[model samples]
Target: MTEDARWLSGLEEQARARLAAPVFEYVAQGARDGQTASRAVDTWAAVEFHPHVLRDVTDVGLETELLGSPVGVPWGVAPSTLQRAIHPDGELAMARATAQAGGVMVVSSNAGTPFSLIGETGVRWWLQAYLPADRTLAVPMLDRAVAAGASAVVLTVDTPVVGTKYPVGRVVWDVVDPALLRVNFDKGTDERPGADKALDLGPHDVDWLAEHTGLPVVVKGVLRPDDAVRCVQAGARAVWVSNHGGRQLDRAVSTAAVLREVIAAVGEQAQVYVDGGVRSGLDVVAALSLGADAVFLGRLPLYALTDGEPGVARMHREVGAQVVETMRLSGCRTLADVAALHAPSAPNHP
Candidate 1:
């Protein structure tokens, strides 16, 4: 009930009440037996923060530079598709909210907005690509994203295949409603192919993506140290430790758990970021200490859009505030201090 408790508050509960059943499932999914979902949070439970009490902790600046670009916070929105499922405003609202929050918005490959429009949003943009098996298709998209003014292009290396989002697809199509559409994709016609299949049906090949695009590429959805090292060697500027919010592979380890290993592998050559079950401000601290340069949110902002863009904007503000408060309480002043806390546990959950 305290002011600092805002990040721990009930945005999800409110969103669940407002959104259609299927729409909720789209944002709030866990693959297979849901083991990964539980483990994602459990990893946080295992990470305990080692707070320093008496320091000259005065100014707390959450600002950090990412890939040489200045950002207001060490966190941003994860690339999530079908954002308009909960609000008609879709990427337009989300982009505005991200800009309003002074954070980056990694636009989805399966986005509601066209690549060009997102480019003009005047916000720092990164394109999150689900690489196609056919280099013919993948390269063109990367080219388009670069042409659209994407500063960095991230290849989502995990989702080689889309997992069974069962009850979500069925319930939404059969029960709730169809407010969402991948407008950016052409649903399989004689001439145009389904973008979903193009993005998913192919096996992953990092070489093509690396060789084709001149953009500073990143590899997202990486959990293995070897893969992280591979990505960086292949010209990636960063590695995003993620499990696709537990929507891709079930029983996969938590994003926070393997972050240190990946960071250690990439060492200082590539920056590290994470997303998956990030629920609070301290979680941000946990990620940074565990070797992440920044963190991303998957479902939290969608909950805000259920009410309106401002509602989602409010969530970003509260999360940032909680992050600052957590820093103050932990005797860490600024992101550098938070980065230095490296508690060897999930920012305090342990």
Candidate 2:
């Protein structure tokens, strides 16, 4: 299927068939047995919606606020590494497409293009950061992003070291050329690490980042409710409930399993967001019904990147359309109605 088909499955098939084997595997698979990745997808697929038929559901809208930013839809693109590995246009293409769809694009700290260049596209964007061995190494990049008009700083806290990639049966490195990963940092030096390099960061690092940056800070890769509480207490503007898209740790609970608790713990204090194996609009509604302010999408966008900006735009519309349709069928006129009608069940978390 072509980009005009506007189907996610087609995008996935196209991306897999077109991308080089290593790049496809690196972007598509998870850590160790890939069970967590499989689980993330499976759990989302299990969400059951109770559609109310008596209400007049002529209009359905999916607009919402995320960390105070007005999002046209209830979902946005989660940060992913090595966009250049999937398409020649890379992060730039994704940013423009997201902007066209009136959604946010969280630019990865490991983006092939410099943050300023992506910012130059005038997209509504945030910078996804990795705390370095020396915090000083991160200062200039952050300052430059703010100067270039990034909306927020999403500080990822889960990866202290790279996790094993079971498909390759090793901690596979060099999946993306090291040269593309360095353009955003250590510009003139030979000392910068590759895109897959792990960060030595923890919750307290949120305090340090809050003190340092003028923009709002959202902590990503949090799965436990207690950790979610700590993130808000440490002054995070939002908590991104994720398991590194199940790429960082094997046997980790799916985000769907732990999201309700994390939202209950920190939703009132900070904006709660989630992303993992969220492939459909029904999945978006499931997350919203459980109290997520917004949901971020991962692999699907990379799959769309195989077809460039039009593909990305199509995916955005496709998902948004799904959300609107689901909302209509479920007898919810707005996101608030969706949340009010559904009471979430607490899931077991790791």
Candidate 3:
């Protein structure tokens, strides 16, 4: 195994040993039968690459832009909630680690840390939100995120309601302090009539968010090309191909399986980002090869956070190093070069 892979496995072992059974399960388990979650990693592994051998690879660059903002690497941390259950530092630790690595972070709407504190860390971040049944309830949080310096808004469109996971030994919400889950909202927000996830989400909601927040909106959880087209047409800056980490839909297609189609559908109208089963530097290159503008990590960083901030930093360093190595070995000098490596008939090909 590669060093990063081994190190990640070790961290997972450490986390399993240190965390409560339910907390670990909360981060680890997926929806019923876990079929989609189980297939994600292998689906990415199944992707084949045809590397160029003779090109000079001595100087490789990993820099790229997301929503027009520059990032040091092509991969960034994806948003996940209830991080405090894994570590005391929670979102602050993640922000610091991501800033140190020179990558962007997507902060969960249900984040344990305050928006201002996460912003204070100097990591470029975007806010991920679920529009409540009463859309007005989201205004305060969106305003707070913008005032806190969030670069963009990622609207997660997959969950009308939380999915049913196979019952764990213990549920995370029942065992952990409720205060750590949604510190960003008002005390009685959950009990309010409009606080539930909106079931009637439509393209108009995309337009409403952009008009309301005056920030670029990224429609996440899109698996179909038609859905991607609709999001971009509705003024989304990007469409994230995700299946909610296989937590929302058990049989949902893996991101790796639909990235090319989504990229093709959106074309240059907007950027395409993806998360789900991205585990290594090689996987990052593979996604880029398939036409993804950037890749995101969901569970990996959380697993690293078990060791606290420095552990997360180390995880970034390890993955970054692996990315550099993969670039050199594949004979790529830039992110654009990685896209060129795709086959002529590939959906991303011009």
Per-model TM values vs. the true structure: 0.88, 0.91, 0.96
Clashes of 3: 0
Evaluation by lDDT, superior candidate among 1 and 3: 3
lDDT of 1 by residue, 183-287 (tens): 444344213443334444222355556566666777888889988887777777888999998888998888877888898898889899999888777787788
- Of 1 and 2, the candidate ahead on lDDT is 2
**Residues 1-350 of candidate 3: C-alpha lDDT, one tens digit per residue:** 24545685476677888889899898878899999998988988887877777989888898998899889998899999989889999999999999999999999999989999999999999999999999988888888899999989999999999999887566787789988877878778889998889999999999998888889999999999999999988999999999988999999998998899999988999999999987777788888999999899998898999988998998898888877887788788999988966674345555
**Candidate 2 residue lDDT tens string, 1-350:** 22343476566788889988778888888888888988887788777766666877888777788878788887889998878878889998999999888899998877788877888898889989887776777877777788878889999888888778766543225555776675766664336543343355666778777778788899999999999898889889999999988898999999988888998887578998999998877788988887788999999999988888888888988887788878888889988888854654365699
- Model 2: per-residue Cα lDDT at residue 116: 79
Question: Model 3 misses residue 190 by how many Å?
Answer: 1.2
Candidate that scores best on TM-score: 3
Query: Quick one: ranking by lDDT, best first?
Result: 3, 2, 1
Off by more than 4 A, model 2: 1-6, 167-175, 188-200, 344-350
> Where is model 1 more than 4 Å wrong at Cα?
1-8, 173-181, 185-207, 344-350
Which ranking of candidates, highest TM-score first?
3, 2, 1
**Better TM-score candidate (1, 2):** 2
Cand. 3 TM to true fold: 0.96
If both were scored by TM-score, which would come out higher, candidate 1 or candidate 3?
Answer: 3
Q: Who is ahead in TM-score, 2 or 3?
A: 3
